[model samples]
Target chain A: MIRRGLLFVIIVAALALAPPATAERLIVSLSTHRVLINSNFTGTELVLFGAIELADPDILDRRGYDVVVTVRGPQRNFITRRKAQVLGIWINAESREFVEVPAYLAVSSNRPFAEIAETEFLRRSRIGIDYNILTQRIGTDIADVVPQDPFRVGFVRVMRAEGMFSETPNGVTFLSSTHFRTTVPIPGSAPTGTYEVETLLIANGALVTRETTAVEVVKQGFEALVAQAARDQRLAYGLLTALLALLTGLFASLVFRRD
Target chain B: MRRLERRRPFGPERAHVSIYLPIAELPVNLFVILGLGIAVGFISGMFGVGGGFLMTPLLILTGVPPAVAVASVPSNMAANSMSGTISYWRKRLVDIALGLVLLSGGVVGTAAGVWVFGVLRRAGQLDLAVSLSYVVLLGIVGSLMLTESVRAILRAQRGEPPVVRRPGTHAWFHGLPLKLRFRQSRIYVSAMPVTAIGFAVGFLGALIGVGGGFMLIPALIYLMRVPTTVAIGTSLLLVLVTNLIATVLHAVENRTVDAVLAFTLMIGGVVGAQFGARAGQAMRAEQLRLLLALLVLAVGVRVGVDLITRPADPFSVVATETFQ
Candidate 1:
C-alpha cells in the first residue's frame, strides 16, 4: 500500500510538472453571421456559444478557466479635435488624426481584465479597449501613445459616448465545465462591415487557445438602394432629387390654387 | 468601474415613431421633424419668405449634421418659393426680364459659393462660418427693419401720409454703364447694379441656405426704386431659380442632401403654407414687419450667445471618411 501510494504521488507530480501534451482547443459559433440594418434597426445583441475541448482529460480537473471575447468592426480613420477659446470665441485649436482604427470595438470578459491576467500580458495581447493600439498622427510623427495619452483618451471617450467603443466585465458566462456563452452588442450607429469576433481561452492566467469568426452588417432594402444610387449615379440622383422637389412645389400650387 | 453600462438601444421608448434617414444615417422622431417643418413653413408663408435661415439652424440644433442641414435646405426653399412664384406670375407681378439678368449673375455666384462651402467643410470651419454669417447679416438687417417699421407705425399714428419715392433721385450705382429698362418694374437702371445685387443674393442663398427675400425685396424697392408688388414677385422668382440650382449643385457636389428628410419637411411645409397665407392677409404689413424683425434678431442673438459661451464639452470628433 505504501509503494502504491508513492507511485501515485510521483505520477501525479510528473503530470503536473510536464508541459501540457496538447493545448485546450476552442470552438465557437455565433447566433447569426449576418446582421441586416433596415429602416427599423435599433441596435441588437448577438449570442456567441463556445465549447472548450480538452486534449488531456486528466490535465486539470479543477476546470478553472477564463474567457475574453473581442468584437472589432471594420477599421477607418478618425479626427479628434480640442476646442480652445480663440479671440474670445471657442474654436477647434489642435487636431489629431487617428489612422486605421477600429470604428467599432467591444471587449468583454468573464471577469475584470486585471483579475484575469497581468497588466503586461494584457497590454501585450491587446486584450482590452485600453490596450488596443490607436495610431495617431501628431505633426510629423505617426505612432500610438501610452494608455493615459490625452488624445487617445479623448478619442476613446467620444467613441464610448457614441457607444462604438465599450468594455463589459462579466459579459461572458460559463454554462458548464466546458461550455460558455456571451452576448455581443451591436449599437444602432454601428458601421456596416465585416466584424471579426475573436474568442480567447485562458487557463491559469495564461492564454491557452483562441478562435476567430466573422459577422457582416449590411444596409438592406430601400435604404441600400438610395445609398447606392447616391454613390454610383450621383448626377442622375441629384437631378432626380431636384426634379422631385420642383414637381412637389408645382403640384402644391395647383392643389392650393389662389386667384 | 470595470463594468460599464451599455447604451440603451434606441428601442422601446423611441420605437415605431422613429424614422431612419439613410443619408443622415440616424433615426429621428417623425412627428417632431414634421412639426418643425410645418412651423417654419407657416412663418415663411406668412412672411412671404423662404424660411431657410430659420430651418437650417433649427435642423442643426435638432442633431442633423451641419453639412446635411445646409445642403438639404435649398431643395426645401425651391419648393416653398415655387408656389409663391406661380401666384406672382399669374398676377403679372414678376419682372421676367430683370429676373433673367439677375439669374445670369446668380449662377456664377452660386458656383463660387458651393466651391467655398466645400473648402470650408474640408477645413472643418463651416459651422463657424455659418454661425458668424447669420449673426452679422441678421443683426444688421433685423435692426434696420425694426427701425424702419417702427418709424412707419409712428408716422401712421401721427396721421402722416407714407413717404413717397422720389423718382429723380439716383444712387451712386445708377450712374454706372450698361443701362437696361425693366418694363414690368417701370424703371430704367444700370444692369451693373442689378447684376451685382443678384450676385450678392445668390452668394448669401448658397452659403447660408437663405432665399434672400428679405434683402432682395428691400434692395429692389429702396435701391432700384421698383414697385413693392413687382419687387416681391421678382424676388420670389429669383429665390425659386437660384435655390433650384443650389439644390442640384449641393447634391451633385456634396451628396449630403437627405431625400427622406427633405420630403417630410416639404409635405409639412406645403400644408402649413396654405394656412399661413390666409393668416398673413389678416395682419397689417407694418406689424408683420416688426414681428419678423424681432424674430430675426432673436435667432441672431441665440446663435451669438452659443458662440461666445463655453460649450458643454471641449472635444469634438469626426470620422475621417467611411471605409466604403
Candidate 2:
C-alpha cells in the first residue's frame, strides 16, 4: 500500500512539472523517408508539411510564427586546395583540410534569417548556410588560434558553386496560421548518406521549440552493387573490369567478320 | 469515387530506372551509358583503335571522377580492341612476331612509365607533365599522319603508282643487327629498332592510360615500314597485351577500376563494333587512313585548347582516396 501511494504521488508531481498539454505546438510529417536512385534519377524534391498548434487565442488572431527548415547531409572530411600562379600557370599552392563537415547542406527560412533571429541565435542554431556549421578539426589550424574563417569561407563558396550548398531566405511558405510547408531540393550530384532535417519554431522574435528528423539517401540496383564492390572488393572489381573489356572486344571482333 | 492523383513536378521517386556507377558514385540513365558505349565502340571498330582517348574524356565530361575515368577507360578500350584483334587475326593480317617483339618492349616501357608517373605525381606535376606530353605527341603524330595520308590520297587520285616501302628497301634499317623476319608483314628489320619503337609506344601508353593502337599504327607503318593491314592488326594485338597488363596494375595498385562502368560501356561497344567493321570494309584504305589522320588531329587541337585557355577558377580540389 505504501509503494502504490508513493508511485501515485510521483505521477502527480511529474504531471504538474510538465508543460501545459495545450502548449503542444509542433506537429510534423515528411512526405517520404527514403530517396531511391535508379537509372532515371535526375534529382529529387521533398515536401515537408507541418502544423503549429497554439494555446493562445491572440496568436491565431495575428500571424502564426516563423519557420526555418535546414537539411544537411552526412559529415565527412574534405581537403580544399587553393591555386596560385606559378610560372605563368595555375597550380595548387595552399591546402586546407577539414573534418566532420557536411558533404551537402541546404538552408531555407520563411524570411531572411537575419530578420527572424539575432546573429547569436542564428549561429547557435546554424539556421543559415554559412553560420550553422559543425566544424571539428581543420588541417590548417596554424597557431591553433589564428582565424580559420578564410579557408572556411572558401569551402562554402566552392560547395555553393558545385550546387552542394544552397540557401534561400524565403523558401518556406505559410499557408495559414496553423500550417506551413517547404520544399527541399536534392541535386543529382548529392552524395549518398543520411540527411538531417531540422524544423525550428519561432515566436515573438524569440526562440521556440525545434524538431529534428532524419532521412536517408542511398543508391540501389546495379549501381549500388558496383560501388559496394569497389569498396569491399577492389582487386576483384578491377580484374573484372579488365576482363570485361577484353571479352567485349573479342566478342565484337568475332561477331562482325565480313570475310 | 476515386480522387485523381496529382503528379509532382520532379522527384527521383518518379524515375523508372537508373544505372548506378560504383566508382564514379553516381547514377546514369541506362540508355545514355549504352548509347555512349555504342558510339565509342563503332569508332573503335572502324579505325582499329582502342577508343580510350575518346571514352575517358567523354566520361569525364559526363561527370565521372577523373581518377576513375583514367583508371577504367583502358580496360574498356582493351575489350573493344580485343574484338578487333580477333577479327584481324582470323584474316591472317596480324604480324604475330612483330606484335610479340613490340609487346616485350612495351612491358619494359610500361614499368618505366609507371615509375615516372609515380615521381611526377608525388611532385604534384603529373597533370602538367601529362598534358604537355599529350600536346607535343599529338601535334607531331597528327601532322605526320595528315601529310602522309594526303600524299597517298593524291597519288591514288592521279592513278600513279603508290609508293610501297618493301622489304630491304631502307638499307639503313636492313643493316641493323639482330634482324628478324615477320612473314606476315613481309619485312626483315632489326629487333633493336622494333623493340625500341615498341618501348616508346608502351611507355607513352602507360603514362597516358589510353590504348596504344592509334599512336602505334602510324609508327609501325612509317618507321619500321610495316604494311597498313599488318600494322593495324599488330597494333591492336600489342594494345591488347599492354592494356590487359595496365588494367591489372591499376586494379591492384590504384584500385581505380570500376567494373560496372567498364562493362556498361563495353556492352554497347561490342555490339556496335560489328556494324562499324562492316562500314569500314566499304571504304578504301587511303580514305580510311585520311579519316583516321583527321580524327587524330582533332584530339590534338582539343587538348591544345585546354592547355592555353583561361580557367574560370585558378583553384581546384584534388580529393585523395585516403577516405576511400
Candidate 3:
C-alpha cells in the first residue's frame, strides 16, 4: 500500500513539474549512456527511443511529423592526402587539412533530410552531414568550401568507408503516433570520447522541437590502464616494457631448458 | 525499420575470441595472432634466425598498422634472443668486452634511427622506406645465402674437401687506433671498426625492426676474422641488448610499442620454437640454408611488387596525429 502511494506521488510530481503544453516537446532516452570498450570489444549498437509530447491528445497528425537523429563523436583534425606518381612510385603529394571535424558522425532520419526541411533551414540548422560546415586549411586560407569540393568529398568518402561516418534515410521508425526509435552503430575503430546525440522533431518542413543527450565511450579495465600508462608515464612505461621483455625471454628459456 | 549495422567482414557473433590492443586501439582475433607467432617462431627456430623480418611483414598482412607492427617487434626480439644469449653465456663463448663496446655504439645508432623513423612517418614516407629497405636487404642476403649453399652442395656431391681458412690473419682495420683486446675472441681489434659494425646493426634494427644477425655474423667472420663460435655468441649478445634498448626507445619516442601484442606473440613463438629446433637438427645444414634463402627471397619479392604496383585508390586519409 505504501509503495503504491509513493508511485502515485511521483507521477503527480512529474505532471506538476512538466512545462505547460504550448508547443510539441521532445522526450528522448538512450538504451545506454556509457559504452565500455574492453578486451573482446568488436563493435556495438545503441538504441534511442523518443516520444513527442503533444498539447492535444485526441488529434493525431502523425502524417506531417518527422524525426531526424544526429550522433556526433568527439572532434579531431585529420589530413587527407592525394597520392601522385613520382618517379614511377606512388607517394603522398598534395594534402589538405580538415580542422576540427567530428571523428565519427551518423545521421538518421524518418525520411530523406531534403524532404523534411528547406535547404536553407537544413544548412542553417546543420541537420545533415553535408549541411554541416567542415572547415579546411588550404595553404593559407581556412574556410569551408562547397559540399561538392573534391577534398571535402574525398574526406567524407574515406571516413564513410572506415565506418566512421554514415547516413541512413528512413532510419528512424515511428512505433505509434508519437513514438519513434533508431539504432546508432559504433564501429570497432571508434575513438573513445563523449558522443552527442541530437533528436529533432520536424513538422511542416520546419523543426518544432529538439533534444540533446550524451553518451560516453571509454576504455575500461586493463586496456584503459595500459593506454593511460603509455600516455602519462611514457618513460616508465618504456622501461617497464623493456623489463617485461627481458623477463619473458628469461622465463621462456628457463621453462624450455634442455640442460 | 532501417538496419544501420554496416556490412563488416566479421560480425560480433563470428569472432568468438578477440582481444583489444591498448595502443593499436583495435580488437584483433587472439587466435590469429597466436597462430602467426607460432608459424614465425617455427621458421626462426628451424633456420636459427631471429624471425623478426618475417614476423613484421606477416603482422602487416594481418591488418596491423605498419608503425605498430614495426615497433612491437623489438620486444619480441628481446624475448626470442634471451634464451640463446643465456645458453651462449653459459658456454663461455660470449666476448663480454666486445659486446659492451658494440652496445655503446648501438645506443647512439638506435637513438638516431628512432629520430629518422619519426621524420619519415611525419613525411608519410615511413611505409615506403620500410618496404624499400626490406627489398634491398632481403634480396642481397637471400641471394648470397642461396649461392653459398648451392656451391657447398655441389662441392659435397663432387666429393671435394672443404676449404678451411688459416687463423690469425691481420686485416687492414686491425692497424687502426684504440685497439681493444677481447680475451674470449682471442683478438685485439680496433674499437672503431667494431663500433661501426654495431652502429650499422643497431640502426637497421631500429629502422626495420630486425636483429641484424645475418649481417653481423658475416661481418664478424669475414671482416673482423673473429672465430665462428665467439662471433655467434657475441652477435647473440648484441642482438639481445640492442633490441632491449630499441624497445625502450620505440616506446618512449614513437609510442608505438604494444606490450599486449608483444606478449601474445611471444607466448606462441616460444612454444613453437622448441618443436622447430628439434626438427631443424634432423635436416642437413645446406638444405636448411637453401629453404631459408627461398623464404627470404619470397618475402622480399612480395614487398617489392607492392612498391612497384599502382595502388587502387590514389587518395589516403589519416588523422593529423596518427601513430608514427
Second chain TM-score per prediction?
A: 0.93, 0.89, 0.89
Give candidate 2 misplaced runs (Cα > 4 Å): A1-25, A55-64, A82-94, A134-154, B1-18, B108-130, B166-180, B190-193, B321-323
Estimate every model's Cα lDDT from 0 to 1: 0.82, 0.73, 0.81
What digit string (tens of lDDT, one per residue) describes model 3 on residues B1-324? Answer: 000111232335556788888887777778888988788777756766678888888777655667778888887777777876887788898899989998888888888888898888777677778888888998998888788778867887899864324466777886899988888787778999999989988898899887777677767766777776688788888888888888888888888888899999887777777777778889976787788888888888888887767765556676765431
lDDT of 2 by residue, B1-324 (tens): 000011121223443455566566555666666788898888888888877766765666565655566667777778887877887788899998998999889988876776676565545565666666766877787788888879988999999888857555575666788989888887778999889888887787767666777788888887778888899999988888887777777666666677777788888888877777778889987788788778777876776666566555544443444216
Question: RMSD of model 1, in Å?
Answer: 5.7
**lDDT tens string, model 1, B49-84?**
888888988877666667777778888888888888
lDDT of 2 by residue, A81-136 (tens): 56565665555567665666788799987899888978878777777876766453
Clashing pairs in 1: none
Kindly report the docking quality category of candidate 1: acceptable
Task: Output the number of the DockQ-best candidate.
Answer: 1
DockQ of each: 0.45, 0.38, 0.41
Which model is ahead, 1 or 3, in terms of lDDT? 1
Q: Judged by lDDT against the true structure, how good is candidate 3?
A: 0.81
| Residue pairs in collision within model 3 | none
- Scoring only chain A, what TM-score does candidate 1 earn? 0.88
List CA RMSD, all candidates: 5.7, 7.2, 7.8
Ranked candidates, highest lDDT first: 1, 3, 2
